[model samples]
Target: MKGTISHRDSFLAHIQQQLGKSSSKPASIRRPVWKHRVNWETNEGLSKEELVEQLKVQCQQIHTRVVETTPKEAPSTLRLLMKEYGEGPVMTSSDRRFAQYECHPMFQALQKEGISVTSWNADTSREENIRQAEQAKYAVVFSDYTLAESGTVVLSSHQGQGRALHFLPMMYIVCIEKSTIVPRMIHAASALHRLVEEGEQTKGAIHFISGPSNSADIEMNLVVGVHGPVRAVYVLIDDE
Candidate 1:
């Protein structure tokens, strides 16, 4: 004997019946209104300088270092950071911002000093890029956004930057522009939402990194650098 299978509509209808509700869909769906907009309101009135201070305080709690410098002074500041983080096999993302901020020349200067520095090459194979990142003592990338409240640096991965570049290195250095610092994650979310609404192509893996990789065991003893860079630093450039 052959058995008959229920159609999708009938299966759904049966479920609706069991729940004692009509199978017909609602005429119009409405999004629920939020009773509180604390996420959008917190630190909303802070000036840029105040926000920078807030970010510094948050970074302190997260064990990440924050350095402030003007765009003209950024190269020297970065060089200092590189020295403090120790010798390298350094890797950096091929972000155009390096040249825009006038720091691209520093990389060339480092090369002349005989330090091995590699930038993410779009033409290179993934395996090669991963190998370079894995072997590097430090990886530096520019932040797309920095959240003041959480000391998080937002990184978006594209052709010139892979996810491994941020995670495979021993130390992570982020160049964050002061203008890109937001009060919290909500501001970043809203900006991204607007981009999507305006039909902008924002395709990439968005990473919200709070600090160096750290986790606690069952006994509550925290261990750092288990899964990612052991040290993280944010060099905040006062571009504006």
Candidate 2:
């Protein structure tokens, strides 16, 4: 009976020690709790058509600035835009002949021009994507969604595409299908949270890239590529 009591007391003391240790430990850090609202709904005064028009004008203004600010040290705007978009002769397999075209189809032409083209598979390894992004001049990423008002592309930062792919390269080219463009950040956040709640097990990093990376901090002189991409181009396609 005495032995049994002593054992019980020791076990109780062990539990108390664990509890005391836990109490002395610092609390774990937590993600900021944010109160979110849908952007379009919150801005109910503006109709969808009005919002899209405003967003397009804003995007065009920003794109023009980016193009203009690039030192005249570069070529003409048309030339630069073409090269920046992609370089390759257009070909239609069904046509069985080569044709000239611009934009996405031109990605093939880029490869023909000796530029490295990497197709990020659904199951691509994250580390490889980073290495490729660091070395490649540009990468064309098909985005999960885009925030139209902010001009930000939402990337999962899962599988073959890492967050670095969005920021590390000198230039980033994102293809945002028209339908996926939401009016604001809140909707994007909600979509992300819904994915997480569905047991998608996404990584912790989410990047909102609005425009090219630049800083006016150096003697108040603006410098591109200060922290991230020197240029970012978004190709908005019709949802169809």
Candidate 3:
């Protein structure tokens, strides 16, 4: 009977062997330090103008348009954008930013130009609302922060601010306040994390977007807007 081992005996022996080599000490897994606890200091010498210039260059490299304007000039800038890009069957964000944009004269101007500008968050049939965004030539949203180092804008996802507003449209425009510009993505993440932890804002997810979505996956050919907006724009609001 000892000449050959049964499957059960073999399995038990394997388990015993594993247990014999296993450490008896408690696991010492190092947890990731949250942003707030980090001690690293980023360089603070760069002025807002310098940061914006850096961001503009990076954005253009990735084919995203960067428009610099004060709050007072934003409406005119938007009007020019519509003219340059051609008025869109546009869908605006349902987020709080919509209310802000609506107060602008450009909103009325867009309507006067016979451009189909609609809200993604309006009280309408759910399918109809989605259809509007899906068919939109341009979709608009507000950025929580713009990371200058990478020319990335951070979007907070909520019921009012859906992913559709960022990715589904052919062109995406982000209304970012100059005051929200951070030197790096880590700084932006840390700020958002603190806000979430302190219950200052509630959001489902945070999106760190850099330029128009592009991938060099198919035959190494760089293709843009395959999964997201083909063109992305940043409206830098000087007066927050």
Candidate 4:
């Protein structure tokens, strides 16, 4: 009877101690929304037409072109675009998005046509690969998300994607996944915050590329690619 009473008392004390600790802990604070509305509806998804309109306005301000195409035709479209560039090496990161094209007939045709193409691989050193990319005419990269309001695309660089890959090549082709498009920069920020909160492995460098590199510093000549890509092509993947 005494042992039972002691055990019950100990359990009761433990419960009280836990309650006290919980009470001592600070309450979770709630943040009020500051601003949300943009040119389009924040709570709704953007159609391809809507996206194109918003993207064009933004891309124009920064001297970039918007290439809108469906997933089925994207590979072929890019291949045709590259053909227009004539004979020049193309560099790309080993992003999973472009990996599908590696085995596709469309990509194989490009290789058969003598299009010098290379992608960064795990076996090779990144510095060497980046140097190689610097010599290439075009660099194709995966864009994580695009901000409809500002016309800026968010590109997070991790192990596979390097910071050098963003700037080295003369022409940059940003492949954006359609579903990841956000209405505004705040939405992208919120997504990043959520990623951190959820303990996701985040990128070391997050680049918000507005457009091709521009400089008015030297005699206002307005030189492009003085610092980065001379031209940027944002390829929107609607279906893929």
Name the candidate that leads on TM-score: 1
Which lDDT value does model 1 have at 95? 91
Error of 4 at 17 (Å): 28
Residue 172 miss distance in model 1 (angstroms): 0.6
Worst 10 residues of 4 by lDDT: 35-44
lDDT-wise, the better of 2 and 3 is 3
Model 4 Cα lDDT, one tens digit per residue, 1-240: 454445876677688797875434347778865575553356348675686578778888888888878777778778767776555678787788776544246656757888767776657787788887888888888787888767798988777777888888888888877877877877787889899889998778788988888889988888877888888888888853
Off by over 4 Å in 1: 1-35
Q: Residues 1-240, candidate 2, lDDT per residue (tens digit)?
A: 454445876677688797875434347677765576344466545555565565566666454122221222122332355475555221111111111113334455456777666654445565665676677666546567766565667776655556676676666666555567677788888888998889988766777776778778879987767897676766554443
The candidate with the higher TM-score, 1 or 3, is: 1
What would the C-alpha RMSD of candidate 4 be, to one decimal place? 9.3
Q: Candidate 2 at residue 240, lDDT?
A: 33
My TM-score estimates for the predictions, one after another, are 0.86, 0.61, 0.77, 0.77
* Candidate 3 lDDT, 142-231, residue by residue in tens: 888998888899987775667667788888888888989988877887788888778876777788999899999989999988898888
Candidate 4: lDDT of 59?
Answer: 84
Best by lDDT: 1
Q: What stretches of model 4 exceed 4 Å from their correct place? A: 1-48, 100-105
**Ranking 2 against 4 by TM-score, winner:** 4
Q: Quote model 2's TM-score.
A: 0.61
